[model samples]
Target: MSSVKYSTRVNSFALGKGKKLPTGNEPILELIALAGTVPGLTSLELNYPEHFKHDSLEDIKEAIEKAGLDVPALQLRWPSPRFSNGAFTNADAEIRAEAVQMVTEAIDLCASFGADHVLLWPAHDGYEYPLQMDYTKSWVWMVQGLQAVADHNPAIRVSIEYKPADPRGRTILNTTGAVMNLISDTNRANVGVTLDFGHLLMARENPAQSAAMCLQAGKLFGLQLNDSHGVADDGLMVGSIHLAETIELAYYLIREGYAGTYYFDTDPVRENPVEECGMNIVRMGAIIEMARLLVRNHPNLPTGRALDSAPILWETVMGGKWNTTVSV
Candidate 1:
């Protein structure tokens, strides 16, 4: 609506949850092909290992090209069967080294694909109960492991994706602030974050405010757009549940200089993945339209040297809803 185009990316596996409903098991090439059919999808965030059918990068690259998409980033899911316990901050030194090696290898793979970023989600890197592990040692090992990965190559951006808790009760690097701390400890400019909206909702952080804060800290490197009930990660379509929050998030993102794509992480379990993803793009566009309308009607909402109050923002957003007599 503002004449500003917002590009979109979909995680390769996200396109066909029905193929393995509630979870995804679609083949890499098929997923790529299906996602490409989605009108607005510009790129993909691939999960390493799973998404790689064979060692032949050419095979995958050719398939992706044939599908009409680009590989912008790769997600390094640390809780795979190979990394059952954890990756970055695993207690065992040997396992930790393997984890670091995996990340470095993924970075090289990303380079091969001409992708600029790698998403590191440490899904199982924390303990479920108290006294089950030594917090100090784990945190130290985690920091060192991350540093090792960051030090591998300064050219490739390593974006850490944080979750409050899911695969682990007390997931390491679980919050935005905690992730920011880890980025600080990593001491690499290329090390930033992939802020997932569903994870933010589960963490009880205002997605809009979190985007603003993370952008301010210069740590918001990537974004995953999805929705949840705030109770669990439903992976519902983006605008299905949290309309206001999603719109506000778009407002902040558009207000800031978010030039990256909104990577779709939705679970289209009973729906057509291609149709659902296209719908997600359209939904995000509607939200962006709301943001555009709010700013258009109340021009002062975003024109300031400092952040506006929450009430001011909510009021402006609420004001966008109107019933005209002509409509009746």
Candidate 2:
């Protein structure tokens, strides 16, 4: 089995899968304790402003320590209702500046926790209709905003998480290619991507291919592992909906020697959060192990042509043995 570092969304514990919120005064602490109960859960990825709303960072850190969990990353959350127009690309100049400031604050918070990076999901930074947004100027503003955030803290990284559309008609960085381009344009070494599997699926992208691209580009900062039906950010557990793709992605991540943490950005609306997260860790480990087995069983499985390797691939994956071969 691969020695993988597992983390999960802390809010999942308190959200109660939309059933009920934690009644405690310090819900963040309670949530941390609940999340820590999951075996093999190595660390946590928490939100900045939202998670800090009730408890102080000191209290949260103390609770995390008590739970034997490390804070690996702090996600910046800017709800759409507050910035429906956009975030970095908001039409109002002050709101854009405020968004940038919020990112800088999140960076500071991340540094305080010795976290790797701040996950920035530009959820509200897109457009609704054609001509509803000023393409060129908005792009410029985005670059400028990102540049400002990068300049705020050169030592810390800022990983951009992209989504195709939701809470908005279309997001600014909707695709992996677009995110790569943004990173290129931002011209900042610390700016990278936190590839969400479901978001990639929604964009009609193959997660394995995107992982390979990001890994090769050296901009693959982290991964938000989850699944969906290629339509929304369903945030389902890994392998629940896209098992093969998850396995393939794991294969590529292993092949590429990715050493970053796997954050379970999932939603356990109806299931126990702790159990669901524990299952996620187990499923990913199994997928990674199976990927290793596949590579070992067939050295030339991905032979640049799907038809050329489909037979042995299926045999090993389905039959658990490479007993047959096809040359064509």
Candidate 3:
């Protein structure tokens, strides 16, 4: 079997204190060079406005090319102060328009790079308290804004990477189902969902089941792979905490033949970025291998009762005693 392709966050190479920059780290070009040094890294996932803050689009593209890395994806990062209220869901129409324009720009750039799609995290598109947001109006605005961008360019895809909550206490499009609903409301072929593993865990979702849902809908456009503690977007290394879930997710993606790149959306604050990414690749490869083993051993594993399936799965994954007579 061919080895799986991998990509990583460019910002992970940036060395700086939290929210503070200029920590004597390399610039984008040098950072791209460093990322290229990573063994298994094949592509680079960049941010639109954030990456553009210092370098021009042409410069960024040239750097990636020089690094021998392809830009498979670009994420939109709306500044907090300006978009604290919201992006597409902002009450201010002007701010909302600006956010939409940023997304469109990212889409156009993504097309230029021959990338897969542009991702919208919408970090600010959420709520903090009850009555803090006009749910109906915000929902309509989000749908219309996303539709406008999807309609703007039919050649490229626009993916929504939903998070349970982060800059706010409660976020819109917090779950895979919610993202599916948004895609349905948008009603665009090019619109899809970016299934983030950490985000799914934060929402207390089963990553494999969520992948199945997206795959069933044919809307699984992108993947941001990482592990979490089921409470926050921890951005831990893949398979670090929830090994079984990650393995199951890999099984579905492999068995169902997902053709998208796996971007390591991790934050390695204390560890070396290159080493952290390399470890992620190793762990993910192991998870995929385990999943492949399960497929080879138990092709119809989940078709039967859970009680019967537990021993097979446990033995297949752990290679140890799984008491078949144990009562659950």
Candidate 4:
């Protein structure tokens, strides 16, 4: 099994109202510096539009270099008012064209930062009324736009994220299966899927199963870490709930030789900004540590055998019957 690595998403809200970093420091530079302070973090995932202004890609790259941290991936929050409340699917041709340009520019920005992955969460692209939406037309527009973006920058990978809904009525790409179908239909190598744990929980989807399926489909490009209770997209710390399931998913990644950044993408809405940032690092470290322990302790667990026996194993471990079943 491969060793697990961790990375964190730098939430723009954590920067507070500071216009610049103190004593000859740029904001991006300061963020990279702060990221270095977190233990076991190999890379940083910067949110777009907020943390990464449209014209600051080069400066961001320079700051990342100065802080000696790698920018593995970027999250592109499409700067469209239509993105506010499930409207991307119904956006006009001009608005859609602008979105395409925004994403293309973001891809270029990612390439400039030496990061190949670009994550797109169409969180507000769903329909409140099922009958009001033309599924075929929306899918055509989405695929066309995405293909254009991919063609514009073949070197950069674009990942679509799935979310059931939150702060909104619905989301278009709301499930792993839906995302997989989109990728399949698009048939573009540069396009893939971003598996966000919080979104999976929000959709009542099993994270491990979703991860496994994405892996099998070869659509998984990156990962987002968070926790929830099968209800809302809480964005809680990883492994805070369903600890055993999380570990099992980690083990699956290790077995599959999945080489991608494990990014901690959380909301700063609940806790103190500074404390939440620090806690994210700590919680993410614990997740990696637990994953590592699972690989180490279960060295004899065959990959094929493990997949076949996963259900019973999960029930036994996560179902809280570990001691009785494993006792000699």
- What tens-digit string does per-residue lDDT give for candidate 3 at 37-135? 888788998877777767777888888988888887888888879999899999999999999898888888888899758888888899988899998
Q: In what order do the candidates fall by lDDT, top score first? A: 2, 3, 1, 4
User: Which window of ten consecutive residues has the lowest lDDT sum in model 1?
Assistant: 1-10
lDDT of 3: 0.85
Per-model RMSD to reference: 4.2, 2.8, 2.6, 5.4
lDDT (10s digit) by residue, model 4, range 1-328: 1344567766523534432212222355565677666555667787666576433667767766666668888787764465654334555777777778878877877887778989888866777776766777888888888788889888899999888886557767878999898888878998999888878888878888888888887778999887777787766666778776777677677666678888777655645544655676665555555566556666766557755456545544455433335546
| Tens digits of lDDT, candidate 1, 82-138 | 676777666678989989998998999999888778888888887788788677788
Task: Sort every candidate by TM-score, greatest first.
Answer: 2, 3, 1, 4
The RMSD (Cα, Å) of candidate 1 is 4.2
- The prediction achieving the highest lDDT against the true structure is 2
In candidate 2, position 43 carries an lDDT of: 92
Off by over 4 Å in 3: 1-3, 15-26, 320-328
Report the C-alpha lDDT of model 2 over 9-31, residue by residue, as the tens digit.
87678655565434434477888
Which pairs, if any, clash in model 1?
Answer: none
| TM-scores, each model vs. reference | 0.86, 0.93, 0.92, 0.81
* lDDT: the better of candidates 2 and 3: 2
Q: Candidate 1: lDDT over CA atoms?
A: 0.76
lDDT (C-alpha) at residue 291 in model 3: 81
